[model samples]
Target: MSDIIAHTGSAFRLTLRRAGRSLLARIGCDCPLCGARVAGARLCAGCESDIAGSMADPAVPRCPRCALRLRHGHCAACLAGAPPFSRCVAAFDYEPPADILVHMLKSGLRLSMAPVLAGMMARACARQGLVLPAGAVLVPVPAGRASLRRRGMNPAAEIARALAGELDIPLARAVLARRRETPRQATLDRRARRRAAQGLYVCREPLAGRHAVLVDDVMTTGSTVRAAAQALIAGGAQDVTVLVAA
Candidate 1:
């Protein structure tokens, strides 16, 4: 009788612990950006609003094709020649608190930020009056094998997964792949980056007659996406659109 009672007590304690954990999870945690308490969300309301406000300001002139901030007219690069992608949509400028969130996800490995960032990207697209063509698919830029090995996951793929859920678009996770591991673009100059990124990506599957929305975490010189878009076009994608969280 004592043994049976002991076993019952252990089972009861285990159930209580699980219930406690579930309750804590529901109660919420601190926001990643401001450290404020948030309920069932990654960021607090104030932080989200501030980040949204910092997104592509209407007053500032920006390139329609690449979203680069401009002083008077379109950027020289966009004007010089047409890029492979039709247009680029960015959730926010790569600065300050927005950049902090991106670094947290990309380098700090805070994977929970993926869905939050995706939600923002969706909102940005709406604000820009952007529309995905019928039958458009979301394709994440493939990370190099070295990056994958170091991070144990691809940040772009995570964002794409969440964005796919938010936009109700099909995700073609494996449709694009890197041709080889190259030096990080952040270390290269503009000309070097462009040259290095050329032919860096290859499409693994045919995308005939389909529009592709290429997703990534950030866009600096735009070389990476340009290369990926070229590969998609070569693989028969009718049109390519670039979407980035930064």
Candidate 2:
């Protein structure tokens, strides 16, 4: 009887401890990104300010098709001929701390950054006055099977899932698949990157009359996304848009 009483008391203490932690999390006194103590916020003030500053640079004019930095409103290349995607929206430039955050999320296995990045992307969309067609689906650029096996998760898919929840849209991961493995785009030049992305993705479901927004972690030359968008259009999507974290 004494042993039983002691066990019950320990269990009660553990339960109380768990409840306390839950309450603290709800209060959110610690920053999720930097782990600093904050006041009634998920991210600390410093981190918020840094993110805002990163997006305030005006020298990097935006390109409408790929959302990349360009000399003109839309790059001369994209203006010469548009890709399959209608528009592109990138939340931050791939520089400094923003690039570090993306690397951490991709290689460091920092899964918590997904929702934060998705929120930034949503804000970017709002700032650019981007609105999806009704019933549009969020399709993530599929990671290669080998990459998925090594990384244990797809960063693009993680971001897409979070963005879908934020926008109240359906996620369609099953519709697209990476049919062939390719070298990392970061390692290749523009010509090599284009060749590497060729025939990399395939669509399995009928996308006829369906609208889709492709989600990715970053866009460099935009070749990989263009390939994915082409696959979606070939599968019968009405149109596609590209959304990226940086």
Off by over 4 Å in 1: 1-29
Model 2, 1-246: lDDT tens per residue?
A: 999999999789767865654464466455666789765423576776676444546765666567667765559658766888999888878887667778878888888778777867877788778989997999999998778997899999999987875676789988888887887666789989988987788999998889999999998888899899999999999999999988
Clash number for each model: 0, 0
Q: Write the per-residue lDDT of candidate 1 for residues 125-159, one digit (tens) a residue.
A: 99889999889999999998878998999999999
Assess every candidate by TM-score: 0.84, 0.81
Of the candidates shown, which would achieve the greatest TM-score relative to the real structure?
A: 1
Over 4 Å off, model 2: 1-46, 52-58, 72-76
lDDT of 1: 0.86
Candidates' C-alpha lDDT:
0.86, 0.80
Task: Give me the displacement of residue 140 in model 2, in angstroms.
Answer: 0.4
Hey, what RMSD does candidate 1 come out at? Answer: 9.8
The best candidate in terms of lDDT: 1
